[model samples]
Target: MPCVLTPDPTAQETPARPTSTSTSLRDRSSAMLREHLRPTIQFLLVGGVVFLLDTAMYNLLVFWSPSHGWGTGLMHGTPLTAKVLTIAVASCLTYLGNRLWTFGDRPRPGTTRSIMLFILVNLIAAGLQLSCLGFSRYVLGLDSVLADNISGTLIGQVVSTSFRYVTYGRLVFPKH
Candidate 1:
């Protein structure tokens, strides 16, 4: 008999490749993540710029004095008012940036409706920020520069930014 090799019929087979269904599911998930990620990054970038502006303006309004020449520890005697002013300016810039850049691809229902929803969402977010600041200033009785920045600028921004991101996507610039 001629020498020949034969494969065993009972041998275990290698794992099968993923089916088209699974592959497509994975692709869809990746696409969805990418879709959200770009906007998230853009939103954060816009936020960073606005944050710097807000911090500077707030500090100037609350802490600055002609006698002190900056950081002189003189209180402007109106922390809450300063916070409101800075947040209002920052919110306006945020709206423009988010509408033009962050969520530009999403369709706008109408200019009036979109603006109204944007303002509503921002008002809620601003309330959250103000609450943080107010709690720190009134409840905790911490009114130093460091305290104000930590409570109002840092912590408040974090909470409000999260709220704004979610609401902006769902209400202001919906994917639909």
Candidate 2:
């Protein structure tokens, strides 16, 4: 007896509606999860680094600087100045990390528009943080160290970090 092999005719046919099938749905969901998980984890890791750097630098400047130090006098208090400077540094670090690792899959690499959008997002985050600080200090009249830390670092960061993650993915490092 002789044997012959033939290709299945259906093997070459493409599905007209992939999404309507259960298998397709499962596959699509799994793929979506995998795709999002990578960037989400990387973004979180980069965010931790940026947060630590920004907070530590902000505290250093706030505590170490003299009352009338070079940049301290520009703002009425050192908290605002420290936050501004540290956030600037953190923003740069974040941009580099997200560009190189988190959202590296973006079509274009380091365009001026991307950088500007990143900066704009960071500026908005800074404003949200500053508002938290102001509310804690002025509206609530809670100007103690603990209060300030809670308001600015915890509350403000929670808000701004959420915003940053969403916007960075959607605007700064959009998936083509």
State which candidate has the highest lDDT.
Answer: 1
lDDT of 2 by residue, 1-176 (tens): 78999889878876676455887889889999998999999999999998888766766665444655533333336576667887888889999999999988787765898989988999999999989988987898875556766888778888899999999999998877
Q: In candidate 1, how many Å is residue 20 off?
A: 5.4
Q: Each candidate: how many clashes?
A: 0, 0
Pairs of colliding residues, candidate 1: none
Question: Highest TM-score among the candidates is held by which one?
Answer: 1
Q: Any runs in candidate 2 off by more than 4 Å, and if so which? A: 1-22, 64-76
Q: Model 1: what TM-score? A: 0.86
RMSD of each: 3.6, 9.3
